[model samples]
Target: MAGGIFVVPLLTLFAGASFPTAVAVSLVSVIACSCASAPQFLSARLVNLRLAAVLELATVAGSVVGVLLVGSIAPGILYGLFAVVLLVSAAQMLRPRRSAQPLGSGWGERLRLASSAPDAGGVDQRYHVGSLPIGLSLMFGAGTLSALLGIGSGVLKIPAMDAALRLPLKVSSATANLMIGVTATGTAAAYLILGKVDLVLAGPVVLGSVLGAVLGARAMVRVNGSVLRVAFVLVLAALAVPMGLTAFGIEIGPLR
Candidate 1:
Protein backbone atom coordinates (compact mmCIF):
# COMPACT_ATOMS: atom_id res chain seq x y z
CA MET A 1 0.00 0.00 0.00
CA ALA A 2 2.82 2.41 0.90
CA GLY A 3 4.78 1.51 -2.18
CA GLY A 4 1.87 1.85 -4.54
CA ILE A 5 0.03 4.73 -2.87
CA PHE A 6 2.71 6.76 -1.06
CA VAL A 7 5.94 5.96 -2.92
CA VAL A 8 4.99 7.29 -6.35
CA PRO A 9 3.88 10.76 -5.23
CA LEU A 10 6.89 11.10 -2.93
CA LEU A 11 9.25 10.11 -5.73
CA THR A 12 7.62 12.31 -8.33
CA LEU A 13 7.13 15.42 -6.20
CA PHE A 14 9.89 15.26 -3.61
CA ALA A 15 12.68 13.30 -5.28
CA GLY A 16 12.07 14.85 -8.73
CA ALA A 17 11.75 11.49 -10.44
CA SER A 18 9.86 11.23 -13.71
CA PHE A 19 6.35 9.82 -13.40
CA PRO A 20 7.18 6.69 -15.40
CA THR A 21 10.30 5.98 -13.37
CA ALA A 22 8.41 6.57 -10.13
CA VAL A 23 5.62 4.31 -11.31
CA ALA A 24 8.06 1.52 -12.12
CA VAL A 25 9.67 1.79 -8.72
CA SER A 26 6.18 1.74 -7.20
CA LEU A 27 5.28 -1.49 -8.98
CA VAL A 28 8.39 -3.28 -7.73
CA SER A 29 7.99 -1.91 -4.23
CA VAL A 30 4.36 -3.03 -4.21
CA ILE A 31 5.50 -6.60 -4.76
CA ALA A 32 7.94 -6.29 -1.90
CA CYS A 33 5.32 -4.82 0.47
CA SER A 34 2.68 -7.39 -0.44
CA CYS A 35 5.12 -10.27 -0.17
CA ALA A 36 6.34 -9.09 3.21
CA SER A 37 2.88 -8.66 4.75
CA ALA A 38 1.09 -11.59 3.10
CA PRO A 39 2.31 -14.40 5.34
CA GLN A 40 1.28 -12.60 8.50
CA PHE A 41 -2.21 -11.92 7.19
CA LEU A 42 -2.57 -15.48 5.94
CA SER A 43 -1.49 -16.94 9.28
CA ALA A 44 -4.06 -14.72 10.95
CA ARG A 45 -6.68 -16.16 8.56
CA LEU A 46 -7.64 -12.80 7.15
CA VAL A 47 -7.19 -13.40 3.44
CA ASN A 48 -10.01 -14.76 1.30
CA LEU A 49 -8.36 -17.01 -1.25
CA ARG A 50 -11.54 -18.02 -3.06
CA LEU A 51 -12.82 -14.48 -3.52
CA ALA A 52 -9.33 -13.31 -4.42
CA ALA A 53 -9.14 -15.92 -7.17
CA VAL A 54 -12.42 -14.85 -8.72
CA LEU A 55 -11.83 -11.11 -8.40
CA GLU A 56 -8.28 -11.40 -9.69
CA LEU A 57 -9.55 -12.66 -13.02
CA ALA A 58 -11.15 -9.26 -13.66
CA THR A 59 -8.26 -7.36 -12.12
CA VAL A 60 -5.56 -8.93 -14.27
CA ALA A 61 -7.50 -8.32 -17.42
CA GLY A 62 -7.97 -4.65 -16.52
CA SER A 63 -4.27 -4.33 -15.74
CA VAL A 64 -3.37 -5.50 -19.22
CA VAL A 65 -5.62 -2.86 -20.69
CA GLY A 66 -4.07 -0.21 -18.46
CA VAL A 67 -0.57 -1.19 -19.57
CA LEU A 68 -1.56 -0.80 -23.20
CA LEU A 69 -2.94 2.70 -22.54
CA VAL A 70 0.15 4.02 -20.75
CA GLY A 71 2.09 5.01 -23.83
CA SER A 72 -0.86 6.81 -25.36
CA ILE A 73 -1.83 8.91 -22.37
CA ALA A 74 -0.15 12.19 -21.44
CA PRO A 75 1.54 12.77 -18.08
CA GLY A 76 -0.80 15.56 -17.01
CA ILE A 77 -3.82 13.35 -17.68
CA LEU A 78 -2.27 10.54 -15.72
CA TYR A 79 -1.65 12.80 -12.78
CA GLY A 80 -5.20 14.04 -12.93
CA LEU A 81 -6.49 10.51 -13.02
CA PHE A 82 -4.42 9.57 -10.00
CA ALA A 83 -5.73 12.54 -8.10
CA VAL A 84 -9.29 11.66 -9.00
CA VAL A 85 -8.85 8.09 -7.84
CA LEU A 86 -7.42 9.15 -4.49
CA LEU A 87 -10.22 11.61 -3.83
CA VAL A 88 -12.88 9.10 -4.79
CA SER A 89 -11.38 6.43 -2.57
CA ALA A 90 -11.26 8.83 0.34
CA ALA A 91 -14.90 9.79 -0.10
CA GLN A 92 -15.97 6.15 -0.29
CA MET A 93 -14.10 5.27 2.89
CA LEU A 94 -15.67 8.18 4.72
CA ARG A 95 -19.18 6.95 3.91
CA PRO A 96 -21.12 4.81 6.35
CA ARG A 97 -20.57 1.13 5.65
CA ARG A 98 -23.35 -1.18 4.52
CA SER A 99 -24.52 -4.00 6.76
CA ALA A 100 -22.23 -7.02 6.42
CA GLN A 101 -24.93 -9.53 7.34
CA PRO A 102 -25.23 -12.38 4.83
CA LEU A 103 -27.80 -12.27 2.05
CA GLY A 104 -28.47 -16.02 2.53
CA SER A 105 -28.74 -16.72 -1.21
CA GLY A 106 -26.23 -14.83 -3.29
CA TRP A 107 -22.77 -15.28 -4.80
CA GLY A 108 -21.32 -16.11 -1.40
CA GLU A 109 -23.09 -19.44 -1.25
CA ARG A 110 -22.83 -20.16 -4.96
CA LEU A 111 -19.08 -19.57 -5.09
CA ARG A 112 -18.39 -20.26 -1.41
CA LEU A 113 -16.71 -16.90 -0.86
CA ALA A 114 -17.82 -16.51 2.76
CA SER A 115 -15.36 -17.03 5.62
CA SER A 116 -14.53 -16.05 9.19
CA ALA A 117 -11.71 -14.18 10.91
CA PRO A 118 -10.83 -13.57 14.53
CA ASP A 119 -12.08 -10.26 15.86
CA ALA A 120 -10.25 -8.01 18.32
CA GLY A 121 -11.54 -10.21 21.17
CA GLY A 122 -10.40 -13.40 19.38
CA VAL A 123 -13.88 -14.45 18.41
CA ASP A 124 -14.19 -16.08 15.00
CA GLN A 125 -16.53 -13.65 13.27
CA ARG A 126 -18.19 -15.24 10.32
CA TYR A 127 -18.93 -12.89 7.40
CA HIS A 128 -20.80 -13.34 4.17
CA VAL A 129 -19.68 -12.16 0.72
CA GLY A 130 -22.28 -10.84 -1.69
CA SER A 131 -22.62 -8.95 -5.01
CA LEU A 132 -20.02 -10.87 -6.96
CA PRO A 133 -20.76 -9.02 -10.19
CA ILE A 134 -20.45 -5.60 -8.56
CA GLY A 135 -17.27 -6.61 -6.80
CA LEU A 136 -15.79 -7.94 -10.01
CA SER A 137 -16.59 -4.72 -11.85
CA LEU A 138 -14.99 -2.58 -9.18
CA MET A 139 -11.97 -4.89 -9.09
CA PHE A 140 -11.51 -4.48 -12.83
CA GLY A 141 -11.45 -0.71 -12.35
CA ALA A 142 -9.08 -1.12 -9.44
CA GLY A 143 -6.76 -3.30 -11.51
CA THR A 144 -6.65 -0.72 -14.27
CA LEU A 145 -5.82 1.98 -11.73
CA SER A 146 -3.10 -0.21 -10.20
CA ALA A 147 -1.36 -0.60 -13.54
CA LEU A 148 -1.81 3.00 -14.62
CA LEU A 149 -0.83 4.60 -11.30
CA GLY A 150 1.16 1.81 -9.63
CA ILE A 151 -0.67 2.00 -6.29
CA GLY A 152 -1.41 -1.76 -5.87
CA SER A 153 -5.13 -0.90 -6.12
CA GLY A 154 -5.62 -1.51 -2.37
CA VAL A 155 -7.06 1.98 -1.98
CA LEU A 156 -9.82 1.04 -4.37
CA LYS A 157 -10.08 -2.64 -3.48
CA ILE A 158 -10.76 -2.06 0.20
CA PRO A 159 -13.64 0.32 -0.42
CA ALA A 160 -15.07 -1.86 -3.18
CA MET A 161 -14.95 -4.93 -0.98
CA ASP A 162 -16.76 -2.97 1.70
CA ALA A 163 -19.37 -1.06 -0.33
CA ALA A 164 -20.01 -3.67 -2.97
CA LEU A 165 -19.26 -6.97 -1.28
CA ARG A 166 -20.02 -6.06 2.36
CA LEU A 167 -16.72 -7.43 3.64
CA PRO A 168 -15.25 -6.46 6.97
CA LEU A 169 -12.61 -3.72 6.89
CA LYS A 170 -9.83 -5.90 8.26
CA VAL A 171 -10.75 -8.67 5.88
CA SER A 172 -10.77 -6.24 2.97
CA SER A 173 -7.42 -4.80 3.98
CA ALA A 174 -5.74 -8.16 4.51
CA THR A 175 -7.18 -9.70 1.38
CA ALA A 176 -6.14 -6.67 -0.65
CA ASN A 177 -2.62 -6.99 0.72
CA LEU A 178 -2.67 -10.55 -0.57
CA MET A 179 -3.98 -9.66 -4.03
CA ILE A 180 -1.79 -6.63 -4.91
CA GLY A 181 1.40 -8.60 -5.51
CA VAL A 182 -0.18 -10.71 -8.21
CA THR A 183 -1.85 -7.64 -9.72
CA ALA A 184 1.46 -5.83 -9.99
CA THR A 185 3.61 -8.66 -11.39
CA GLY A 186 2.61 -8.44 -15.04
CA THR A 187 2.39 -4.65 -14.93
CA ALA A 188 5.90 -4.49 -13.50
CA ALA A 189 7.19 -6.79 -16.21
CA ALA A 190 5.60 -4.61 -18.87
CA TYR A 191 7.26 -1.54 -17.34
CA LEU A 192 10.60 -3.35 -17.16
CA ILE A 193 10.39 -4.26 -20.82
CA LEU A 194 9.69 -0.63 -21.64
CA GLY A 195 12.91 0.30 -19.81
CA LYS A 196 11.06 2.26 -17.13
CA VAL A 197 12.58 0.53 -14.11
CA ASP A 198 15.37 2.44 -12.39
CA LEU A 199 17.05 -0.28 -10.35
CA VAL A 200 19.21 2.22 -8.50
CA LEU A 201 16.15 4.04 -7.14
CA ALA A 202 13.93 0.96 -6.84
CA GLY A 203 16.43 -0.91 -4.64
CA PRO A 204 16.22 1.49 -1.70
CA VAL A 205 12.47 2.04 -2.06
CA VAL A 206 11.81 -1.69 -2.14
CA LEU A 207 13.92 -2.24 0.96
CA GLY A 208 12.20 0.55 2.85
CA SER A 209 8.78 -0.63 1.68
CA VAL A 210 9.44 -4.19 2.88
CA LEU A 211 10.61 -3.09 6.32
CA GLY A 212 7.65 -0.72 6.69
CA ALA A 213 5.24 -3.42 5.57
CA VAL A 214 6.44 -5.77 8.30
CA LEU A 215 5.91 -3.14 10.96
CA GLY A 216 2.57 -2.05 9.57
CA ALA A 217 1.25 -5.58 9.32
CA ARG A 218 2.10 -6.19 12.97
CA ALA A 219 0.29 -3.01 14.03
CA MET A 220 -2.80 -3.62 11.89
CA VAL A 221 -4.26 -6.50 13.85
CA ARG A 222 -4.12 -4.50 17.08
CA VAL A 223 -5.80 -1.41 15.65
CA ASN A 224 -9.54 -0.88 16.16
CA GLY A 225 -11.53 -1.32 12.91
CA SER A 226 -13.30 2.04 13.24
CA VAL A 227 -10.03 3.82 13.92
CA LEU A 228 -8.42 2.10 10.98
CA ARG A 229 -11.21 3.22 8.67
CA VAL A 230 -10.83 6.83 9.76
CA ALA A 231 -7.06 6.61 9.32
CA PHE A 232 -7.46 5.32 5.78
CA VAL A 233 -9.68 8.24 4.83
CA LEU A 234 -7.33 10.78 6.38
CA VAL A 235 -4.29 9.36 4.66
CA LEU A 236 -5.99 9.29 1.32
CA ALA A 237 -7.14 12.89 1.66
CA ALA A 238 -3.67 14.07 2.69
CA LEU A 239 -1.90 12.37 -0.21
CA ALA A 240 -4.42 13.76 -2.64
CA VAL A 241 -3.19 17.34 -2.12
CA PRO A 242 0.19 17.06 -3.80
CA MET A 243 -1.12 14.77 -6.50
CA GLY A 244 -4.08 17.01 -7.26
CA LEU A 245 -1.86 20.09 -7.50
CA THR A 246 0.59 18.17 -9.64
CA ALA A 247 -2.20 17.54 -12.13
CA PHE A 248 -2.22 21.29 -12.73
CA GLY A 249 1.60 21.33 -13.01
CA ILE A 250 2.30 22.84 -9.62
CA GLU A 251 5.26 21.43 -7.73
CA ILE A 252 5.04 21.20 -3.91
CA GLY A 253 8.77 20.64 -3.42
CA PRO A 254 9.51 17.12 -2.09
CA LEU A 255 6.66 15.78 0.05
CA ARG A 256 9.13 14.19 2.41
Candidate 2:
Protein backbone atom coordinates (compact mmCIF):
# COMPACT_ATOMS: atom_id res chain seq x y z
CA MET A 1 0.00 0.00 0.00
CA ALA A 2 3.00 2.26 0.41
CA GLY A 3 3.35 2.16 -3.37
CA GLY A 4 5.32 5.10 -4.86
CA ILE A 5 4.45 7.44 -2.01
CA PHE A 6 7.16 5.59 -0.10
CA VAL A 7 9.79 7.20 -2.29
CA VAL A 8 8.62 10.75 -1.62
CA PRO A 9 9.18 10.63 2.13
CA LEU A 10 12.51 8.87 1.65
CA LEU A 11 13.69 11.52 -0.79
CA THR A 12 12.58 14.35 1.48
CA LEU A 13 13.88 12.92 4.75
CA PHE A 14 17.19 11.47 3.64
CA ALA A 15 18.16 12.73 0.20
CA GLY A 16 18.03 16.49 0.82
CA ALA A 17 15.27 16.98 -1.73
CA SER A 18 12.88 19.87 -1.38
CA PHE A 19 9.23 18.74 -1.29
CA PRO A 20 8.49 19.97 -4.81
CA THR A 21 11.60 18.40 -6.28
CA ALA A 22 11.03 15.29 -4.25
CA VAL A 23 7.50 15.06 -5.67
CA ALA A 24 8.82 15.46 -9.22
CA VAL A 25 11.49 12.79 -8.75
CA SER A 26 8.99 10.57 -6.99
CA LEU A 27 6.74 10.74 -10.06
CA VAL A 28 9.37 8.80 -12.01
CA SER A 29 9.58 6.22 -9.26
CA VAL A 30 5.77 5.97 -9.17
CA ILE A 31 5.73 4.95 -12.81
CA ALA A 32 8.56 2.52 -12.28
CA CYS A 33 6.80 1.03 -9.29
CA SER A 34 3.51 0.67 -11.13
CA CYS A 35 5.01 -0.91 -14.24
CA ALA A 36 7.15 -3.25 -12.24
CA SER A 37 4.18 -4.41 -10.19
CA ALA A 38 1.62 -4.70 -13.01
CA PRO A 39 2.36 -8.23 -14.11
CA GLN A 40 1.94 -9.62 -10.63
CA PHE A 41 -1.20 -7.61 -9.91
CA LEU A 42 -2.83 -8.50 -13.22
CA SER A 43 -2.04 -12.17 -12.91
CA ALA A 44 -3.40 -12.19 -9.40
CA ARG A 45 -6.63 -10.72 -10.73
CA LEU A 46 -6.56 -7.99 -8.15
CA VAL A 47 -6.72 -5.03 -10.52
CA ASN A 48 -10.06 -3.51 -11.54
CA LEU A 49 -9.38 -2.23 -15.05
CA ARG A 50 -12.90 -1.00 -15.69
CA LEU A 51 -12.89 1.02 -12.51
CA ALA A 52 -9.38 2.25 -13.25
CA ALA A 53 -10.30 3.36 -16.76
CA VAL A 54 -13.22 5.49 -15.60
CA LEU A 55 -11.19 6.99 -12.76
CA GLU A 56 -8.12 7.75 -14.85
CA LEU A 57 -10.03 10.31 -16.87
CA ALA A 58 -10.46 12.47 -13.80
CA THR A 59 -6.95 11.83 -12.49
CA VAL A 60 -5.32 12.65 -15.80
CA ALA A 61 -7.26 15.87 -16.10
CA GLY A 62 -6.30 16.93 -12.58
CA SER A 63 -2.64 16.21 -13.21
CA VAL A 64 -2.65 18.73 -16.05
CA VAL A 65 -4.02 21.37 -13.72
CA GLY A 66 -1.46 20.47 -11.07
CA VAL A 67 1.44 20.83 -13.50
CA LEU A 68 0.22 24.31 -14.31
CA LEU A 69 -0.05 25.22 -10.62
CA VAL A 70 3.10 23.57 -9.25
CA GLY A 71 5.18 26.63 -9.91
CA SER A 72 3.00 28.89 -7.77
CA ILE A 73 2.31 26.83 -4.59
CA ALA A 74 4.62 27.74 -1.74
CA PRO A 75 6.80 25.14 -0.08
CA GLY A 76 5.31 25.70 3.37
CA ILE A 77 1.81 25.25 2.06
CA LEU A 78 2.94 22.13 0.23
CA TYR A 79 4.23 20.71 3.51
CA GLY A 80 0.99 21.45 5.27
CA LEU A 81 -1.02 19.95 2.47
CA PHE A 82 1.09 16.82 2.56
CA ALA A 83 0.55 16.56 6.29
CA VAL A 84 -3.22 16.86 5.98
CA VAL A 85 -3.35 14.33 3.18
CA LEU A 86 -1.25 11.87 5.11
CA LEU A 87 -3.20 12.22 8.32
CA VAL A 88 -6.55 11.97 6.58
CA SER A 89 -5.50 8.94 4.57
CA ALA A 90 -4.20 7.22 7.67
CA ALA A 91 -7.45 7.87 9.47
CA GLN A 92 -9.53 6.68 6.57
CA MET A 93 -7.64 3.40 6.33
CA LEU A 94 -8.23 2.57 9.95
CA ARG A 95 -11.92 1.99 9.32
CA PRO A 96 -12.90 -1.04 7.30
CA ARG A 97 -14.77 -0.28 4.08
CA ARG A 98 -17.31 -2.25 2.08
CA SER A 99 -19.60 -1.48 -0.81
CA ALA A 100 -22.99 -0.64 0.57
CA GLN A 101 -24.53 -0.78 -2.86
CA PRO A 102 -26.32 -3.98 -3.72
CA LEU A 103 -25.09 -5.92 -6.71
CA GLY A 104 -28.51 -5.45 -8.28
CA SER A 105 -28.30 -1.71 -7.91
CA GLY A 106 -26.80 -1.75 -11.38
CA TRP A 107 -24.76 1.36 -10.71
CA GLY A 108 -21.38 -0.28 -11.01
CA GLU A 109 -22.98 -3.16 -12.89
CA ARG A 110 -23.59 -0.90 -15.83
CA LEU A 111 -20.01 0.28 -15.73
CA ARG A 112 -18.86 -3.32 -15.20
CA LEU A 113 -16.88 -2.13 -12.22
CA ALA A 114 -18.20 -4.61 -9.69
CA SER A 115 -15.68 -7.37 -9.04
CA SER A 116 -14.18 -9.87 -6.59
CA ALA A 117 -10.85 -10.50 -4.95
CA PRO A 118 -9.41 -13.50 -3.17
CA ASP A 119 -9.44 -13.42 0.58
CA ALA A 120 -6.60 -14.66 2.76
CA GLY A 121 -8.27 -18.03 2.88
CA GLY A 122 -8.30 -18.08 -0.92
CA VAL A 123 -11.99 -17.49 -1.32
CA ASP A 124 -13.40 -14.87 -3.67
CA GLN A 125 -15.05 -12.00 -1.86
CA ARG A 126 -17.38 -10.10 -4.17
CA TYR A 127 -17.82 -6.32 -4.06
CA HIS A 128 -19.49 -3.54 -5.99
CA VAL A 129 -18.27 -0.07 -6.82
CA GLY A 130 -20.26 2.72 -5.18
CA SER A 131 -20.21 6.50 -5.08
CA LEU A 132 -18.41 6.86 -8.39
CA PRO A 133 -19.08 10.57 -8.45
CA ILE A 134 -17.42 10.94 -5.08
CA GLY A 135 -14.58 8.75 -6.21
CA LEU A 136 -14.04 10.85 -9.33
CA SER A 137 -14.02 14.07 -7.38
CA LEU A 138 -11.49 12.69 -4.94
CA MET A 139 -9.46 11.28 -7.80
CA PHE A 140 -9.31 14.67 -9.46
CA GLY A 141 -7.92 16.12 -6.27
CA ALA A 142 -5.60 13.16 -5.89
CA GLY A 143 -4.19 13.67 -9.36
CA THR A 144 -3.48 17.34 -8.79
CA LEU A 145 -1.88 16.41 -5.49
CA SER A 146 0.13 13.71 -7.20
CA ALA A 147 1.65 16.22 -9.59
CA LEU A 148 2.18 18.78 -6.86
CA LEU A 149 3.47 16.32 -4.24
CA GLY A 150 4.92 13.52 -6.39
CA ILE A 151 3.54 10.66 -4.29
CA GLY A 152 1.78 9.05 -7.25
CA SER A 153 -1.42 10.02 -5.52
CA GLY A 154 -1.63 6.46 -4.25
CA VAL A 155 -1.70 8.12 -0.87
CA LEU A 156 -5.15 9.39 -1.76
CA LYS A 157 -6.16 6.97 -4.51
CA ILE A 158 -6.25 3.91 -2.30
CA PRO A 159 -8.47 5.67 0.22
CA ALA A 160 -10.71 6.93 -2.54
CA MET A 161 -10.89 3.39 -3.86
CA ASP A 162 -11.65 1.85 -0.51
CA ALA A 163 -13.92 4.50 0.94
CA ALA A 164 -15.78 6.06 -1.98
CA LEU A 165 -15.63 3.22 -4.46
CA ARG A 166 -16.08 0.55 -1.77
CA LEU A 167 -13.45 -1.84 -3.06
CA PRO A 168 -11.71 -4.39 -0.92
CA LEU A 169 -8.38 -3.25 0.45
CA LYS A 170 -6.34 -5.69 -1.62
CA VAL A 171 -8.19 -4.76 -4.77
CA SER A 172 -7.93 -1.09 -3.93
CA SER A 173 -4.19 -1.40 -3.42
CA ALA A 174 -3.67 -3.33 -6.65
CA THR A 175 -5.90 -1.10 -8.75
CA ALA A 176 -4.28 1.99 -7.32
CA ASN A 177 -0.89 0.60 -8.30
CA LEU A 178 -2.17 -0.09 -11.77
CA MET A 179 -3.50 3.45 -12.21
CA ILE A 180 -0.53 5.17 -10.53
CA GLY A 181 1.81 4.78 -13.48
CA VAL A 182 -0.58 6.37 -15.93
CA THR A 183 -1.41 9.13 -13.47
CA ALA A 184 2.26 9.96 -12.89
CA THR A 185 3.29 9.83 -16.53
CA GLY A 186 1.71 13.11 -17.61
CA THR A 187 3.00 15.08 -14.66
CA ALA A 188 6.42 13.49 -14.78
CA ALA A 189 6.70 14.36 -18.46
CA ALA A 190 5.69 17.95 -17.81
CA TYR A 191 8.27 18.20 -15.04
CA LEU A 192 10.97 16.68 -17.21
CA ILE A 193 10.21 19.02 -20.09
CA LEU A 194 10.33 21.96 -17.69
CA GLY A 195 13.73 20.75 -16.39
CA LYS A 196 12.39 20.13 -12.90
CA VAL A 197 13.37 16.48 -12.69
CA ASP A 198 16.82 15.80 -11.24
CA LEU A 199 18.15 12.85 -13.19
CA VAL A 200 21.11 12.40 -10.91
CA LEU A 201 18.92 11.87 -7.84
CA ALA A 202 16.13 10.12 -9.72
CA GLY A 203 18.19 7.25 -11.10
CA PRO A 204 18.72 5.59 -7.73
CA VAL A 205 15.09 6.19 -6.77
CA VAL A 206 13.88 4.40 -9.88
CA LEU A 207 16.11 1.44 -9.22
CA GLY A 208 14.99 1.13 -5.65
CA SER A 209 11.35 1.55 -6.60
CA VAL A 210 11.56 -1.23 -9.19
CA LEU A 211 13.19 -3.62 -6.76
CA GLY A 212 10.81 -2.70 -3.97
CA ALA A 213 7.78 -3.07 -6.20
CA VAL A 214 8.83 -6.53 -7.30
CA LEU A 215 9.25 -7.64 -3.70
CA GLY A 216 6.02 -6.01 -2.61
CA ALA A 217 4.01 -7.59 -5.40
CA ARG A 218 5.26 -10.99 -4.39
CA ALA A 219 4.36 -10.38 -0.75
CA MET A 220 0.94 -8.78 -1.21
CA VAL A 221 -1.01 -11.91 -2.02
CA ARG A 222 0.15 -13.65 1.10
CA VAL A 223 -0.50 -10.75 3.45
CA ASN A 224 -3.77 -10.09 5.24
CA GLY A 225 -5.77 -7.14 3.93
CA SER A 226 -6.17 -5.64 7.38
CA VAL A 227 -2.43 -5.86 7.92
CA LEU A 228 -1.86 -4.05 4.65
CA ARG A 229 -4.16 -1.20 5.64
CA VAL A 230 -2.51 -0.76 9.03
CA ALA A 231 0.97 -0.85 7.55
CA PHE A 232 0.22 2.04 5.21
CA VAL A 233 -1.47 4.03 7.92
CA LEU A 234 1.60 3.82 10.12
CA VAL A 235 3.99 4.88 7.39
CA LEU A 236 1.80 7.75 6.23
CA ALA A 237 1.26 8.98 9.77
CA ALA A 238 4.99 8.83 10.50
CA LEU A 239 5.87 10.81 7.41
CA ALA A 240 3.23 13.42 8.19
CA VAL A 241 5.06 14.48 11.32
CA PRO A 242 8.26 15.45 9.56
CA MET A 243 6.34 17.16 6.79
CA GLY A 244 4.22 19.10 9.28
CA LEU A 245 7.32 20.22 11.16
CA THR A 246 8.99 21.45 8.02
CA ALA A 247 5.90 23.48 7.24
CA PHE A 248 6.47 25.34 10.48
CA GLY A 249 10.11 26.12 9.51
CA ILE A 250 11.69 23.33 11.48
CA GLU A 251 14.03 20.87 9.83
CA ILE A 252 15.18 17.36 10.63
CA GLY A 253 17.11 16.86 7.44
CA PRO A 254 19.00 18.88 4.88
CA LEU A 255 16.78 21.07 2.70
CA ARG A 256 17.49 22.22 -0.79
lDDT of 2 by residue, 39-137 (tens): 998988888898889999999999999888887988888888888878877887776566464443355777878888887688988878877888899
Specify the poorest-scoring 10-residue window by lDDT in model 2.
98-107
Clash counts per candidate, in order, are 2, 0
Task: Flag clash pairs in model 2.
Answer: none
Question: What TM-score against the true fold does each predicted structure earn?
Answer: 0.90, 0.87
- Residues 1-256 of candidate 1: C-alpha lDDT, one tens digit per residue: 5457778877887888889888899999999999999999899888999988988898899899888888899998888888887888777766777655656437668888888988877899889886788888889988898888988877678767887888887788888888888889998987788787998999999999999999988986677868877887887778788888888988676463
Candidate 1 shows a clash count of: 2
Candidate 1, poorest ten consecutive residues by summed lDDT = 98-107
RMSD of 1: 2.3
| Candidate 1 positional error at 114, Å | 2.1
Each model's C-alpha lDDT? 0.84, 0.80
Top TM-score: which candidate number? 1
